[model samples]
Target: MNGDWLLLGRDGRLSVYLPSDGAALWRAERAPAGPWEAPRRIGGDQELLPGLSIGRGPDGYGHLVAWRPVGTDRSDLVHTTHFRPLLAPLDWQPAGHPNKQGARTGTPAVAVDAQGRAHVFVRNGGGGMSMVAQKEKGGWEPWRDLKGRGVQEEPAAVTGESGRVELYAAVTGGIRHWRQEQPGARPVPGEGVDAAVRPGTLRALATSEESTTVLFTDDDSGELCAWRPGEKPMPLVAAAGPGPVSAVRCVIDGHDCTLVAQRSTSGRVAFAAYPSQQEALGAVWTESGPELPADAVVSLALDADGRLVAATLSPSTGQLRLARRKDEPGLALGPWQAV
Candidate 1:
């Protein structure tokens, strides 16, 4: 469910207005950052994947970053810094880290570690290569290109049960795993990259202190899939076609909650909920009303207290709606507001 009324504009601008007084709070430009002052237009035919994603860290800080367009060759990477509210106007700075060989590096994924430092993993388009970069002390570390094969993309990270940060990346063939190097420790391989799973996009859900689950659609059949920490990746639910999956989050505040918002082939936004991650992949799932969007860029987030918030482009009127999860049935959208 939406907390405040947000107006999602058709021009790709999200105007988050205050619900109480209908005053705009923040308006973020959905554009690509480049060479200090240059503003490059992102997300088009040249750029297969849009160069932006937003996430709130565990410490309640908003993190945002963008990947410089590598054209079709996937080289020439210029990843931006993980910006927070503290550095106004100059919130996003250059990461100051790049591949030594510079084999056309881009498609960087950012995850905040338990200590508040950001961990970025970039994939090389030349030979399905991967590299890990971390911010430490007062500067960013040199890129550590791990030896591996497969088109590594969509890296996901979380502080594991042991407090050590763990990272997962989707491989062209399957999935690869990595952790902060400890002397001579080696990286591991995750489950096979199910051909059914889509490339470059996977939504991860932290189920428990000991387990993490990732959700994606099968590349072949477009069926939904769920992969737990140590379990084999398998089919979760079946879908019509392979459309982008909108942010999947598990809202657990002493209450069992799981919600995944995805778009169907018809351009309608759908929501799926479960008692837990277990139930979501099981035989049953509770879904919300269809929010048909014309442009199809949707995002969802859940508060620490289990309140569901979704933002999407409405297909009918081209408005951005910030809807919340109504405990009842039949589109009882309170907080039924626009941005």
Candidate 2:
């Protein structure tokens, strides 16, 4: 099967790589009140890895980021705007030596803060996490190391309520967290939260306000775990399953909410929603649909029509599948159809 790949744009459009040809594919609704549009290829030949990221700046333009290998030991962090015709390259490791085989490097994460600036975080070839921010007018600041070792997955980032940017990633024994209060401000180091999360399983979502929610699979038990600002990491559910998770903050039924999706032990994908950050810590999870394949990698998002959408990679067929929640009287997820 193809590697896990996905990009949820700020405009509620979901993009995924076609397994057959490695082409970029996107699906979205035509309008807020319109029907869902069929999935279509977006025109690209690059074979993207699992942790692709997409974000929209204040200018109403979307930015996509991914890592492209240029040589045996080097990979360039490439990005392109929604309106641009070509990808722009960003050197991830200017001074570090080329990465030999079997060395772990993290995927890139990008988020746009309130000031209309884009912030990017990625693991360098030297095994340290680094960050860079876009200038107000145009261009990027020099890369600054966040100083962590053994980061083998993509870092999680969010633009907080007060316009602060917070980043988190799995370190040696726990997760490292960092925050920048304002644009171009120095990053403040925070205490690492203790947890045995599996490498590459951590994902986070930030509200428009002050709280952040982190999700991961426990390395030992394989159960889903969550962490908020002050509270310690807690298990969202007790059963062990394949620990793929994705989260997003969106307005549901006219109320702001955080939605989290995880694979359950029964092979079905389940989802939970909290009206606010305070309620998420104690909220109950609701199962979305029938059993997906046990080995499927799942990604979740809300469509422009405000419907919950799920994309799954079928292990046996090596194809991508799309499913949606039927807005009937109850919470019913539709059957998975080939994209």
**Candidate No. with top lDDT:** 2
Candidate 1 Cα misplacement greater than 4 A, ranges:
1-50, 69-89, 96-98, 101-104, 125-129, 159-163, 180-195, 247-255, 279-291, 313-319, 327-336
Clashes of each: 21, 1
Each candidate: RMSD to true structure? 8.6, 5.0
The best candidate by TM-score is 2
lDDT for each residue of candidate 1 in 190-216, tens digit (9 for 90 to 100)? 444444457655666566666666666
Q: Model 2, range 143-224, lDDT digits (tens) per residue?
A: 6877877776767776666766788888878888888856668566677887887877777777546677777878887567
Deviating ranges (above 4 Å) for candidate 2: 1-51, 56-60, 83-104, 250-257, 278-286, 313-339
TM-score of each: 0.69, 0.75
Cα error of candidate 1 at position 102, Å: 4.5
User: What 10-residue stretch in candidate 2 is worst by lDDT?
Assistant: 88-97
Which residue pairs overlap in candidate 2's backbone?
Answer: 161-209
